[model samples]
Target: MNDSLPGYAERLDALHQALAADFRAIIARLPWREHESILDPGCGDGFFTGLLAERLPRGVAVGLDTSTAFLEAAEARLAEQIEAGRVRLVEGNVDRLPFDDATIDGVFSAHSMQSYPDLPHALREFRRVLRAGSTLAILETDNVHSIMLSWPPDLELAVRQAEHREIGDEDSYIGTYFPRFAPRLLAEAGFTDLQREYIFIERQPPVGEALERYVELYLKYLAEQTSGRLDAAATARLAEIGDPRSKRFLPRQANFFFGSLQTLITARA
Candidate 1:
């Protein structure tokens, strides 16, 4: 197992549990074919892959991920589907797919494109493997679009700016450029009929435990990432609010609210 697999899976599971309804709704919105094969590249743990398989009762969901550990976890999660022959998890890289050209009927990727070693090369590979007129759907979000807590807007803005200044070009922050570049990149890669949608999820006080836990983890991540980038007072404030045991924990505040926006872009090959 990868050294970070436990933490990575926990964070993904918490987020999935918290926003499960929205995630299902988004996947349900896609146009599915009952007898066509769909490729889910970068399908870690098969969370979204299982949903894709559910939509295609008679079709197959081919999940391709680079990590053997992640594929093992995905296999365990989708054991029933795998036995039914509706889902298949493979160890492979997105940019250099193992399949022949133009063999896939459709492709669905989520929150993983930003991590591709080469964005342009991966986009071409997606186009190459997809049949003519097949759809490619990608769901991604920027740090600015992905989070909104009930804290002060000024502090949030400061943290956002700090993140951009520090690691904006890193894979973790690369999603920030997707909204602006995805269309052109897809077009350049020989895809057509591009479209985009913004999905919003929000919750108020009395939110679920999953959401609360996700928020706590996200806060801690933000605090860790911007530890020395922000001013001393701002850094201290983030630490206090991020700590669940602290009196200033924001999740415990009255009228606490949480919201996020994810961008979904679909293109035809």
Candidate 2:
């Protein structure tokens, strides 16, 4: 009964691989304990859950996701780790975690809140299960809110026009204001003592020569994905934004990405 996209598990694994370094930095900061239980709601494919197991030698990590496809992927990937009593998988939704109130010692979720039907309700559920004085950690990309593309004067409007993304929608509130908005939500749900950190990957030419190539191809990619969104003038503008051959293109000193930002927020429960 898993309703996940056909290749979601595979795609998720690939993404985790690409994000391995950032993931390690985020996981390394957890105040691990020998006898603690951690809940990872919406854990996809167990790549991170296995990393958690490696970090928390004596602790138990439980991962929950609605997709049986993902659970199976986790099981297959973490077979030895799961057998050693380090990790467990459950099939459920974060909106209604399958656990008693105030039972979980810690909770961590990533890239999952944006899809929740009722975000505040889900936050309440997260707080309900978390033990008082424990930790709640979230890692997400704040592209919708904070990260602006260096090319466009109005990146938000451009995205809206191109992809039909709505203003003040999930893409607006969580995507834009996220971890920035998280502290307030956590406070309302009775959490305090907040900490926010970010791992940024600048998509600049000097970061690598491939970035120049990436930038150059971006215009064509954009045009393919969204045909009429860019007119002739916009095409010329995009070339200036992305084409390394253009005189107006960015020099090596500018450390900027096209339109992406990744962030991690940790707070007390």
Candidate 3:
């Protein structure tokens, strides 16, 4: 339980692999054009930013992260793009972007804003940097609990409620209120033509062995995150339910759907 959480970057790399398809699909929905300059706020490993650069050939993708370590890794991961002048890695904050007003053509943040201390302030900054009519796409999930599991709806709700109290609104756990909250925040930030799409990848839900591996990986991290906050029996119960062979899995799937809302939202600046 005392282990440091600095190793989280490795966990994110695993996540990128698991959700790569969904990532690509979400990016495809954006209104893309040649030479469009994009900002990837909180671009951890720059994998997505590199992908963005690859897809946009002539376009530029500036990846911003708080960690110099992550930025170095990004620089290495995006070597080709950087060489081609399509990628730039910056160590910066979302609430206070480094670019001048109305400088960037578009802003794309994926599962990153949850880490921002002030969501409204970050949105406002994003609005400031983006040119008039430029697009801003944000993809995040607050329903990470009981997803890819077979447990009762009540059990899922219970877990979600607990996590909500523990990890109020952080990168590891942002609760389900975003479905309602993000729109209001965007509207108030002067972003118009707000379009949101609730993306639940039911067509390719990780099942069998894949589901088992993901559940194990996520549960281990969750156990550490909630260490002293969770009772022994509660922690044990999570392990039991996460097991693919557990009897509760099927019933849980029946009680609730087999997917979570990995939503993608877009707004015009």
What digit string (tens of lDDT, one per residue) describes model 3 on residues 1-269? 23222567666676666657767877876896868999999998897897788667888999998887778788888898898899988889876899999999998888776577777788999999999999998877765522554455565555656665654443333323454578888999999998888777642333444434555566667666666666677767776765557764432354432455677789999
lDDT of each: 0.85, 0.69, 0.73
Error of 3 at 36 (Å): 0.7
Residue pair clashes in candidate 2? 145-176
What are the root-mean-square deviations of the candidates from the true structure over C-alphas?
A: 2.2, 5.0, 4.6
Cα lDDT of model 2 by residue, 55-151, tens digit = 7788888989887877887899889878989898998986778999999988888777776767777888988999888888888776444334455
- In model 2, which runs have C-alpha deviations exceeding 4 angstroms? 2-12, 145-165, 169-172, 202-228, 231-260
Order the numbered candidates by lDDT, best leading: 1, 3, 2
Give lDDT tens digits, candidate 1, residues 1-269.
Answer: 44236555777788988888788899888876877899999998899999899889999999998888788889999999999999998889976898999999999989886677688789999999999889999988865667888987788888888877855354544445577688778999999999999888898878878887888888888888887889998988888887789887887888688888888899999
The TM-score leader among the candidates is 1
Off by over 4 Å in 1: 1-7, 167-175
lDDT over C-alpha atoms for residue 246 of model 2? 71
